[model samples]
Target: MNKSNIAILVLIGILFSSCTMKKETMPPNILFIAVDDLRTELGCYGNTVIKSPNIDQLAHDGVLFSNHFVNVPTCGASRHSLLTGMRPISKDYLRNDITELTLTNKQEQDAPETFIHHLKRNGYHTVGIGKISHSADGYIYGYNEAPSTKQELPNSWDELDFDYGKWKSGWNAFFGYANGENRQSLKRQVKPYEKGVVNDTGYVDGLTTKLAISKLNQLKKSSKPFFLGIGFFRPHLPFNAPKKYWDLYDRDSIPISPNPMIPEGVNLKSLHESGELNGYKLGEEKASLNHPVSEQYARTLRHAYYACVSYIDNQIGHILKELNKLGLDKNTIVVVWGDHGWHLGDQQMWGKHTIFENALKSPLIIKVPNKYKSKSVNSIIETVDIYPGLMELCNIKLPDSLDGKSFVSILEQKNMQTDNVAYSYYRDGISLRTNRYRLTKYYRKEEPTIELYDHNSDPFESKNISNDNKEIVEKLIPILEKGNKEIFY
Candidate 1:
């Protein structure tokens, strides 16, 4: 062949390689959905009672983490750990006001160093709606005060927003009842649950879903890849939902907890007296281990919770449907995660304040662009691990200081490994979850200093067999101690 023919072939080869590189380098858009106080009680997670078709459908198309645990069980601290990709350093870090304090006292760095901040720096348009942080709209405000100008995560989002609707501010929207009365204005004398006859838009989460859907349309036109975080507040408290959702279940048919009593041989300090539930003084009889709640009320509470779950599922379904309609689903990575789990009268506790299995374990589902086969990973993984996982998924550079390691490989492998372990810290208690056991250690010098439960034998964690299993306790103590160093007791 002549030199001219060889030159023509090389030019064609160069153009083809350039196109391939450009396509490979294009970052995928991220749709991060955060649900509040959601437990692993959905139909997908083997709970045959709850009707969560939308979330179950998402799980059918993606990966469902059967053993996903959070760093902290409460809302604020759990979200703080999730956003910062760090463990709790002090007792103050465990409070609901961590967002208000941290953003107020931001470090000398030019920009906030949260994961979303890093994403913004990397040419992604980060938009947050509703309660991504402790605040409802990612802004700071008092209990009954108007929304302030202060942003909770200053440099992390391009646009931090919320639709308070009838309730004036994000805080108010969070505690808003069907009649626009909040827990504060009513002086905490509200009922524990409500069955509103209004539509989905009657509550705050419905408004949030509307705003998020609108933002999705706008984000579709952006030049750069986008990271949209939509946080829903239903299934958190005052379990209010449309009567349509309430009608989905029979109140009498809801199953009560098999083990309603406090764990045997467990210290009372290890459990709380359902303080959050007791705050709603109207029609609520305080529940305790000694004086257990009535079985009828327990069933009613469970019914309300399931209704809220289905209500949120409908909202999620709407947002996901819009994503596909806009042709964004092909290039977007969808993640539906619960900040932490909740206790629905498990161990006679109605709130999430302990290091128990029900409080720490939540639902986590992820769907990449091309991988759509249904898969469930039963390995131990922490909420902190989300940062590195998303970074790896989007081909972004993982920061060296992040406490979590990427689970992208685990997704590809589609199986659990023997070495998988998750660590969680709440107050002075430090717990570690392994493949078959959950071992918790409180920083106290007492007889019940340790609490261990074998998940293989007792999945519900009804009994604490710490004292009986001396050999297992000896083996897991050092593992739990490894994560305890970060928490200053």
Candidate 2:
């Protein structure tokens, strides 16, 4: 290596060594919580209608990242990127089965298997509950099939578990309804939303919370520092929550999506027909890309989503309460992340799998227990950056093959000195999200293939201004291509 490169490496080594020395006495435990398909519309993110008081309180107490995007909008791929500290280089990285197809049933090797495995290798006992990886309970199984004996991340967790409750299996609990039935078992003959008149333990997320709380009690008594991962499935499809959470908001109080129409000047490739949301065969409305859903039906769906969000928020409140009650809150590094964002009728789309802002930007909050105060980061950061950032937080040596950079310095400084950008890939499109602009390039043909939306002027992404801003498009294409490690299929 050149002299300057060698010197930089030496400096980084010394810095990491110092952090290691600091954590010798009492290494912080991590309470890594991942929520499935949550958007950035919480009260903390400036949404006035949603009742996410607990999440808002956490944002008040921790650092809130306003511009957090995932590498891909699909669940498994996004979580894989977060675990491996890598970005999408090929079509395999874009699939929702990336984790199960690659990591499940694989043997542990010399290098750490994932960020969880990294913690396990460094003397930390890692425990995972619910869907930390792609599988609902970290087990490999089809949505319509019986639960299998396979574990998703065999090397990552010392005690990987999920309480299936009455649903019987991981996939059932994942696609489960308020009653014992699930969409898979019912053959998709169910409605898209539910407001069951039951208690907190009515839904699967309630049971997941109960399991997480029980695990926290056991972990507090353990001798070793623990890395507890709690994953909650909520605000996803078949939005099911207790009636109490649904009662938290009036139907009219919930607002409709501001940008429900397709942005002008964009081709048909940029739009989706909400197929995932329509998979619940008995839904009242089938979403269309050409015209938005009826106004009242849109509000009802948003209400269901709001109720689910509040339900998960309440579950998270219970977990954090137990953490503080056990006195582990002071020493635990808490991270609450949403795997990816949902459209919620934005841009006439219902689910993820698009490179739109709503699909890619999710909620991210980190509390390092006095390491950093409550702050907001507006600069863009992708999900791949999270794995290395966690390693740095725990004083572990980051793997050399990581495509992400630790945000520890950004946390310490509360500012972005680097060129902070987030890149996302989906459906033959590569999108770059910066603080001010979103530039997207699609591989489809026979249309105005480039799409650009200036966030500074139009945060809702109402129109594609690429033709109007040729100078900005030329300036950003090279930067976007540099981050694409494309191993074309």
Candidate 3:
């Protein structure tokens, strides 16, 4: 018990405290990756057939939200919901041209804009490549016309970039083929599936990966922490990829949809005639509730879709490798997300405009630096929650008017019970999904005003048990009404 011994112990304690404080004060960078029209059909999600090693590894290293949904099923509206952290308050917000007239007409002073803009204003160097907003290159342009000079999300990023390569523009690159012809130039006569003999560079997603890697290298020298958004367009229409990707899948082994028929007792108005898939003039067959697609065609289409998913997974693998190579993985919060899910001949539908579980359920994986432990959460979460969640994780100032509640606590606590209900809208129909049931109501005057499906009994939603389950309908109607009431006033 000497004075010298007491002085030495106090000095050691002070040094240890300083090291912990330095680690806590350092801000982390962000790498946000968006994939288009991807579903929960990966090896990580327990789909044994499809091969997705890289994405699966990410899930193994990060936390996966098992039941993640979008506020809107379509691409533009869904991304708007995520970026703005709000639901569709107006008709314009529900459509693909989310910024076309709304941004110009509706002016709010001192209002918080998209999350990217907020990040940029808060000392983060924001950079976007590919389709972060409604447009392909974060700029507005018609699908067939030449590219325009206007930015879709103005003042949101320090740089907006895209590498169109032989396609010349972002829109063209989205639909471009191996032979340098796009659907627009071909007048929409392209087939729904194509296997090219060229390498991965023959596609637009490959070029996107190259540009993102280059940006990472450049950002490494910058003094401030960065927020980089990278979007990949694949597993979408005209499913085209390299021959090597296609070779990875055996055509005969691809499986068709287990629940391919239209749900019993469901109104026909609730479904559509696979319009997006039929848009390709060279498509062999038409799909409808009256007549489903042939099994052979379905298998072929599934094979192509799986190949595209594998291709995009490879591109993701490349970008993640580049991040680790640049030594950014340890200090960056990496997120891999799909804007919305797609239907591979589910419910006799081929696109993503429905309010069904197949169209709304997508993949979500978040990896925090030095905190990854392969966690999985089954609580229902919406895509709008991403905005506030990122802000909270980065320790940035959160603004008012955010509709999403942050889920950072869910990452820290394994058994946390998050908001169990997720709401989605498509056209005039609104659907709400709870832990065990999905209740949908159409605003239009239809024969069946309410459609209810018990997820516990029918996970595939093979039948609409609305008529038989009156008790469940009564319990869920009030919840839906309250959500509807919020849309106005």
Candidate 4:
């Protein structure tokens, strides 16, 4: 009687314990990839010229947003707003360089909270591979350190030293005084070398990708969730990539920009007056138009940019492969985004200072495992939304101070509307890109001009329809005024 009773009791206890034990659910890992100065010139974005097979494949596999823009166009300002989930207008970060933009030195230390910090607090191991937040304090931003407990990646540029002065100014060896005056400048200027060249052995994009691959491999064995930020610095200034990439495109095949030269008699007085176009030195219209940049040179530049993009994409593929190999792809959320769009000889402009669609739009791709797959969202989304979107995707509590709303619903539905208008502000101009229209208003007292483009009819934004469509202008004027009144911080 005693043996039978004891055996029955033990069996009953074991069954009850099995039913009550809590099953551990691992939190989804995040693969955050950021590219510097990348425009919507990829194959997925309908640019037939640039070769971005890896990125195009990613878009095909995941959800790609047709219209995505950044808070600001510059690096530091854009990154600051992106990390803090605030607009450049709100943070007063109107320009590059954190020290010059943020007034107080202590303000840098007590800056707005970042999504990375939030992830770290939520038991996720945060590791920033490269160019995450300008790397002010090495420890805070994860620079000059080995990969975390999550993974290990070899540092390609750890031993290399960068000569910023020689790189930017291009003097053989220039020395500056204590007051920041140039003491001596050499006569011969050093030519800028492309990446993968012997001189550019320490390319930032290559180094960053190498490190990221290492981290991805190491994270395979970790039990804790990880947030890996892989930032690629490419297609920016100094246009650097491997020589092979430069040879990918045919010289004559490289198409010239539709509006390569600015029209004659069209007044650029406003741009010149604003001091914004100060150093960009505009030559005579005839000279500028007649000066022949050989097809070879044009092809070379295009090839370099495209090659850098491919390089980044290859690295991304490597990381994604590692995730799949580690059995993490099922539980991981991957987001690939470019900071802002770049101009390739559009409106006679080369860089991204202007508020054109080519300069504003960015590539935004999100893959949320089994939940959100094979979806394409055409809604206009701002970079600010990334902060809240990540929080919602991971089911993490978002900070109340964040100004962005989670557009997680848009990921499911192709035509979901989170906001009626997506806003982008430059120094004195505010651009409101709605579903079908884009309106830009210059806030100059003397010459407050308005430029409007009906994207439905004019996707290329060639004609300024503001003057012609007076009725539509009247309809959108009130909305634009209201948006201008609302602070974007």
**Poorly placed runs, candidate 3 (over 4 Å):** 1-24, 104-109, 485-489
Number of clashing residue pairs, candidate 3: 0
TM agreement with the true structure for every prediction:
0.94, 0.94, 0.93, 0.77
Model 1 residue pairs with clashes? none
lDDT (Cα, tens digit) per residue for candidate 3, span 374-482: 9998888899889999999999888897878788877777436654688898858779999889999988777785889888889988898999889989999888776
Least lDDT summed over 10 consecutive residues: which range in candidate 4?
151-160
**TM-score, predicted candidate 2 vs. hidden true structure:** 0.94
Model 4 Cα lDDT, one tens digit per residue, 36-149: 778887888888877777778778878888888886776667776677687654425656554223422332233324777677767887776655554321112132232222
Worst 10 residues of 2 by lDDT: 480-489
User: Across residues 87-139, which tens digit of lDDT does each residue of candidate 2 receive?
Assistant: 98788889989987788857878877798898888889899998888989888
Per model, state how many residue pairs clash.
0, 0, 0, 2
What TM-score does prediction 3 earn? 0.93
Which residue pairs clash within candidate 3?
none
Better of 1 and 4 by lDDT: 1
Which residue pairs collide in model 4, if any?
151-218, 152-214
TM-score for candidate 1, please give it: 0.94
